[model samples]
Target: MSPIELNKRQEEILQIVKNNGPITGEQIADRLSLTRATLRPDLAILTMAGFLDARPRVGYFYAGKKSAQALGDTMNNMKVKDFQSMPVVVRESVSVYDAICQMFLEDVGTLFVVDEQSLLVGVLSRKDLLRTSIGRQELNQIPVHIIMTRMPNITTCKKSESLIEVSRRLIEQQIDAVPVVAEEPAGLRVTGRITKTTITRAFLSLSESHEL
Candidate 1:
């Protein structure tokens, strides 16, 4: 069914049901000082929209914010693996100048910094390169490891983790992207990447699916 927005009276009816529910239609009409027939259409719309559930003889009850809660649960259950993109990786020893070039060439806002063994070591962003390049006597001589956010400080997520959790970390930590990694004997190994754009796309897809 197409989404229907509740009117003011409908909202008031919902609030009344929430405050005192399993309430009969007559009781609800009485609360508003209106006849039961006047409230019938509103109650029917709410019940059919899933905002309120009614029983044969028992009465009407609040459905616990079903629409919002259902959307939240759907987003929380979406896995990072389903939305992550291939990571753009550069060695930690790579020069800051070279890292900047790679970032531009890859057209990404952030780059995953890894060790020679392909283990995740750090993360470098455009801001880091710009800040370091401003006053640097020798840009090519500066290693990314010196300016990049190192391990333990870098926020990483696993493929199996929820996109909701990843999105939360991204917002809370104020980072452009997160490296999707797998635990190894030595350290976390980069597998993929999740960016703000990726989250936006995922949300759009979810919205379309729900609409369908």
Candidate 2:
């Protein structure tokens, strides 16, 4: 059913589950100022809608990984088979000048640096590009492979990894994006990207709810 079909009470219950699910029924009723009997129907409706799951001890939980349902699914369901878009990448041999141009043209803050085999080698950001360019380095000759962040140190997520984990890394590392990689018989392949903006937007949308 469409979101519009959800009544105010149902939405409120959803918000509660999203924020604090695995919460007990008594806790929900107390917070909403409704007795358990009064709240039961609303809870039942939401669960039936595929928006939540009622666990044995954990009263209820949002169906997706966290509070943000659609956003959570996108993060948890990272099998590359489920991602709708491919991530943008640049070759390690490219010039800093060229990388800067691409970053600006695409209006993105991060760029993935990869090898010919499509395995991710490093990550370059606008900061990295600008720092190198201020030294008046040759625009066409300086390869990004020199300054890019190399792996096994570079943070990455497999296609099966959760986006929430990726977002946490972004905040902790103060980076804008994480490369989504997939392991194949040939080796690891760069598959997609998870960005801070996507996670931020998903959470930011929650503020529109006034129920708290």
Candidate 3:
């Protein structure tokens, strides 16, 4: 979602905070010759948009912006486990028809295929299903393993990994989502997933956080 542009009063409030941070709302109100109630919404907007940080007794402090390096470092420090969503899975033996149905039911662009042991085996993508649908083969009879992106070719990540690294992989490979896996003795176990939407939500959530 696009951010709300600052209004004239909001801009003035930011300037005041930037110059003398940890300043109380009452002081700011006095300077503006207006009641604190009038400035309430403006203060909330600034804090919500990452422009200000307010403490219990310390008042509002300036958190206008960070340097590019600082911002990158902050993003890199974020973990996948903190942001990933639940994984959507299917059995490799399930028919392409069932996989496609499940994709639509779950509203997901990708599905992870697992074997009997519930270990990662392959992946089914929208394109993979579409290609199969165009063929003469029966969708219900054809197992997903026949059309899914198979082992050694499937991309996976760990919950302990960084979002930036996973995001880079997603961009380079042009894939929609990456399964967060756990390395088992026999195979990888799917625990969660990180998609383009997940990365985007992370940024938005970060802006709402107290950090700048």
Best prediction by lDDT: 1
Give the RMSD in angstroms, all C-alphas superposed, for model 2: 12.5
Better of 1 and 2 by TM-score: 1
- Model 3 C-alpha lDDT per residue in residues 1-212, reported as the tens digit of each score: 33445666778888899898889989888888987856765675566556788998788999865322244555665777766788999998889999999999999989999999999999888989999999999898999998889889988889888889999999998898989999989989999998998888766645543333
TM-scores for every predicted model: 0.66, 0.59, 0.66
Model 3 residue 160 CA deviation (Å) reads 0.9
| lDDT for model 1 | 0.83
- Clash list (residue pairs), candidate 2: 78-159
lDDT by candidate, in order shown: 0.83, 0.69, 0.81
Ranking by lDDT: 1, 3, 2
What TM-score quantifies how close candidate 1 is to the native fold? 0.66
When superposed on Cα atoms, how far off is each prediction in RMSD? Answer: 15.8, 12.5, 10.5
* Residue range 149-175, candidate 2, lDDT tens digits: 888778877655554666678889888
Ranking by TM-score: 1, 3, 2
Better of 2 and 3 by TM-score: 3
